[model samples]
Target: MADDKETAEALIADFQKSIKDAFAVFDHESNNTVDVREIGTIIRSLGCCPSEGELQEMLAEVEEEEPTGYIQLDKFLPMMTRVLLERKYRPQPEDVILRAFEVLDQTKKGYLTQEELTKYLTEEGEPFTQEEMEEMLSAAVDPEKNVILYKDFVTLMTVEDT
Candidate 1:
């Protein structure tokens, strides 16, 4: 009985350590708010803990499981660490917008339609709605003038929200 208790305590300690490490990665990587769902997904994939259920229930399960048998923490930690690092190093919003414009300008025609912008954003795996694209163009274009010049496009792209 004592042995079981000891194992349970040790396992809990290790899990706590893993959670801390995971949070550190999130902190390092996140420029904006960290999405709770994304963190939960990462935690579940590591198999250090179960993905769903109340926190108390999850802790109880960890306490019940013996420390001697579990996934290798060493292996899982590094993978999660890499993910956090990548997120931390991700490009800024301006860079993303600039790249999007460049992609839309591939034909070098100096203007982009809603369809082109949508296709570019989709290929980049960035989420963009048709309405959003239309709105962006509306703000950038003087519709009485049907073309968006490159300079105007860049200006709109880099404008910081007040």
Candidate 2:
């Protein structure tokens, strides 16, 4: 449990740092934010091949109220993380765990809240002990959002196998 918590914390810290570094590049105006137009460039700089249209769509999905089309780091991080994860981890046949994730992330949101995951696990899917569920949630759930990032979920699954 300690190891899992440490791993989760490290992963989150790394994620935050990566987003900060990337956002700094396009935040040339130094307002600690980037315009929607620069998102494509940022994605490209991250070594991900997303189309202009795709980048536009992701910007549209930002949940915050950005009247000027300028998004802060918090709003931009999730979309960037999702794009990078999708690029890095393809849904191959060998990745059976991904099938389970797809079922939970029904909206294709690339993340799942604890409620969403617990609902499936408790009702329709394989049964888990209360302690087991708690442990999984502790290891994978993001403390800030109380949700599981798809990338973190993947890491949790991968780590469990080893």
Each candidate: what lDDT?
0.51, 0.70
> What lDDT tens digits, residue by residue, belong to model 1 across residues 1-162?
999999977865665576555555555444322334344544643343332353234333333255432223343344445433333322235667666667668887767765565566556554556766677767766576566664566765553431
C-alpha RMSD between model 1 and the true structure: 14.5
Best by lDDT: 2
In angstroms, how far off is 60's CA in candidate 1? 22
| Every candidate's CA RMSD | 14.5, 17.1
Alpha carbon lDDT at 91, candidate 2: 28
Would you list the clashing residue pairs of candidate 2?
A: none
